[model samples]
Target: MARFTDDNDADAEIRALGEALAMLRRERGLSQAEAGQRLGMTSQGWGLYEAGKRSGLFRPDVQRRLTGALDATPEDLALLVRASSTPSALTQPFKPDGLEMRGRIFEGAPSVERRRLQLSSDELAPWAAAGTVLEYVPGRWPRRDQGCVIEMADGSLRARLYVRSDEVELVVRGAGALLTIEKIPRVQARAVSAVVARLDEG
Candidate 1:
């Protein structure tokens, strides 16, 4: 009976840890296959960790490697487990600093509008590859070095990295066979939306 109880406790801890890892991966908008690719492993291998079948997940070195691939720390995984068990933490909506807004982009317009575009070229390269889907929020100003989708007044669209903008022009970088800088007149750009997320297809 004592041995059986000890096994049950170990299983419960493993399951809790796995749940935390899955939550972190989903929060980063990564699929199991995509997350596995970061660690040079197959999706099934990654799934084993999330299914609590992989005992190596309890190792300190393995924890670091797995969490680092997700751009997180092992401490974050532990905290997430604790937070998940708290009822109030689950009820509160996440609001990052400097993101609060009160007004719509335009009269009769929604407070936020998201649009998706599929990349047909590798112009964005390592930042975003060909066949990756970009989710952008229109009317939101992009920060420097962020990805953006630009709509030209002439009905053409471009995906590039945001550099800076002045009264005269908007400057951006294009990553292709070679890096190129482009400056478009402010008057010619109909809209510049910030890319919020990149979804890579498996």
Candidate 2:
């Protein structure tokens, strides 16, 4: 595994905004297609908002439409906006093999950073709820139909079930959305990690 630390953070900001939109949409149990229909567009159009191809989520009209579609509060959007500047805690030096100790060398290393995420959407409702915390182990990729987090270079992160990969893209299905991303270009992502467990905050 190689460490990705680019001097430019523009891509990072866009990813943050997109991740925010996607998270909010999932929280509300709305798929991109569903949200797009409400907004009078196609799923791809709606996805652009979450992909950071579009911008201004805080604009008056943008907020209105997003809020209407996702049932999100203005404060939620504010928090997402503020997250654009969030420094990633996941950054660590890459060690292809596990840390060398007195005995044996660990593969992929226990040094793999574990990320914790709190659910904020209903897209994966029934199976999961808002405020549920999920733990992910990087380098431990998921198999077919397994839940995992897809990390994108834009800094946007998506939690979906792994489907399959081809030359063009990697496919995944959203747990709550019952939605499939048929083609997520391989270039857009940093890596994928398995979602090993979920923790309830209550």
Candidate 3:
């Protein structure tokens, strides 16, 4: 059996969000096929979004791709969330110009709450190519072989493969080189995020 929320407003919001997404697509003069291509999805998949299928559209990872693909802003997405009956982070005040909050962009809009890393080098080629935009969740621990962004005490950033971790250091392999990054109790790197997805576009 299909599940439906007891709240009547929630149902309406889902329909509204889907409709709003379709409207946004049309305003951008994008056909479903074109929009799908930009978001790394097929035309048929894109159509599902416009059909009022999903009752919610605030998924952080999914929104990152959608906004980035359509060149839309957080404020633009917030407008759609207003019609949603459920509480959402998108309903909060946000600047379309990309504001930062706690190392997050757009005031942590669910669609854009994650940190973004554009690969500067093919140091992790075959998995993450140069020019790839990696979206990750902060404070998310990564397991062995997972792609991650590590912050160092010296304020340096590195994209590496998580090999193993300990209280003292984290073993990583990048660019075919094995590296050990020492941790500083308070100032050193203890921050790591697992790469959830990669978006590559010119």
TM-score of each: 0.50, 0.43, 0.42
Which candidate wins on lDDT? 1
What is candidate 1's lDDT per residue for 1-202, written digit by digit as tens? 2554577778878888899998877555466887899999999999999999997888989989999988789999987776766546544554459786454332222345778899999998877789998888878777666688999999888998899999899999985745489899999999999876788887
RMSD of 2: 19.0
lDDT for every model? Answer: 0.81, 0.68, 0.65
Q: Please, what are the lDDT tens digits per residue for candidate 2 over residues 127-193?
A: 4567877677777877565567888989987777678887778888764455545568999978888
Looking at model 3, which ten-residue stretch has the lowest summed lDDT?
177-186
* Candidate 3 per-residue C-alpha lDDT over 126-177 given as tens digits, one digit per residue, 9 for 90 to 100: 6667898877767777756667888876777778777777776677777642
> What is candidate 3's local distance difference test score?
0.65
RMSD of each: 9.6, 19.0, 12.7
Pitting candidate 1 against candidate 3, the one with the higher TM-score is: 1
Clashing pairs in 1: none
TM-score of 1: 0.50
Shift of residue 98 alpha carbon in model 3, Å: 46
The residue-level lDDT of candidate 2 at 148 comes to 75
Clashing pairs in 2: 26-123, 27-121, 27-122, 98-109, 123-176, 124-176
